[model samples]
Target chain A: MEVEKKQQCSELLQLVIDGQATQQQRHELDEHLPKCECCRNEFELSLSIKEGLKSRLKKPNLPSELATSIQSKVLELA
Target chain B: MSVGESMPYKSKDKQRVFNKEFMPHIDAMYNFAYRLTLDEDDAKDLVQETYLKAFRFINSFEEGTNAKAWLFRILKNSFINNYRKVSKQPNKVDYQEVESYYNSESVDEKITTDLRVETVQHMIGDEITNALNSLDIDFRTVIILCDLEGFTYEEMAKILDIPIGTVRSRLHRARNLLKEKLVNYATSMGYKDKRK
Candidate 1:
């Protein structure tokens, strides 16, 4: 791909991955991805990364007492 | 009296809003604070401060508007105002420097990370968490907001006080930086990139 074309594809790829792509843009990317190995790889990798972050990252336990404490404090202020 | 100006709320209504709208997002708020501060005690203080401020200014928050985003905006601002200077994270990189560097000539260069999708899928929670935590705070923030918290670009733009264009670009840069870190971790663990 030419430099300009690649940059445009990259941007469109991001839009699609982020779920911000317009329907037309999504169609355009779908048409282009099958023809471009680089973009297909990028799209897949980016999606996988998002998936990993959502599912694999550990959520810390919110301190059990913190909410109660904040509630009491808010009660005081109110 | 700009938009989002505080409206008059009865004390009863304020309590209602605080319990119904704000309290539900406490877990998310705590997670965001922990990610930003990367410390337990600080996260606790930051979240408490945010909630108190939220209650004090509850009138400004319209009832049906996005409470999560509004709360996030407050927590983010509080983090900047109070905690950033005393951040335990050493050698914080300036956001301006990172932004300029990412926007320059190398912006288009695809960061080569030697991690396959399979490897990324196989990564444990701690590996992914460590990779995320390793990023500069600004870059780390976009990922947390978009990926973990599921904020839209518009909401993110509002929360971070940046333009929509900046939000898009920053998220792009942040994801690539994260990918690089994940791939580096994969390589260190002897995972191979089948594509390469």
Candidate 2:
């Protein structure tokens, strides 16, 4: 597996999504993404996949009985 | 054990708060527990115990802190202090035994057809899941956290109590492993071989 030289924009794109981008980095990527085709597509794809996953995650409902029992146990320990 | 009593606390008013707030979180906790314990029954027991401990220590939950993260903190502590009985975790699978590096590499006389590409693409999701399940827990958890759960590298570091560099490197390894698995599954499914 050859390691491709990671573009500054790719790094920035990841940082921005993770909310770890600094002001300068964010500004730079914001400017770069429109001009950089690969970075733009990558960012769009990741964002779409993220949203799709969250939407598709089935309603995380436990059984009502499980809830009742766990709740009692929670309060008991409290 | 409540028998036919209609479950005494089932009617308690604060019970609504518990149901609405804490219960839905069990699945996530179960998933995380499975990763740590690697046994369904043990994971289930750990989850139940974690919930019990959470209930006992619910008052210590500071209101403003993210409740889910707090709950995870409690659960992680429980695994570490109470249930990670061994001094160290078991030996992991030697990735070398599984790594088909020659196949992973681009080479002559191999793999360049449209039908194969389509088949490979189609099985990506399930293959990725199997690959993830195969990796050592640490690598798999980082991938699940960063890629699947969309946690920031820093957040993953905090959750796993590792450094950010470890998170990034592990994420890279995990993703590559998934890609390899997808390719192998497609090939071994004999989709590519039969057409040739």
TM-score of each: 0.92, 0.61
What local lDDT score does residue B181 receive in model 2, on the 0 to 100 scale? 52
Query: Model 1, range B1-196, lDDT digits (tens) per residue?
Result: 0236657889888888899999999999999999999988989999999999999888789888899999999999999899888776556556577567555534444553355678999999999999999998888998999999998888999999989888887887788778888878987888866666
Off by over 4 Å in 2: A1-13, A16-65, B1-21, B35-39, B80-121, B190-196
At residue B195, give the lDDT of candidate 1. 63
Q: How accurate locally, in lDDT, is each candidate?
A: 0.85, 0.55
Q: Pairing residues by index, what is the TM-score of model 1?
A: 0.92
Candidate 1 Cα errors over 4 Å, as ranges: B1-6, B88-113
Docking class of 1: medium
Per-residue CA lDDT of model 2 for B1-196, tens digit only, reads: 1113332232353345445555667878776777666666666667788877655554455433455665666677777776566625646534454333322323211222212334543443445456556666656666556655566776676666767865554554454454455457666766554545
Positional deviation of residue A19's Cα in model 1 after best superposition, in angstroms: 1.3
Alpha-carbon deviation at B73 in model 2, angstroms: 2.5
Clashes of each: 0, 5
Q: How accurate is candidate 2 locally (lDDT)?
A: 0.55
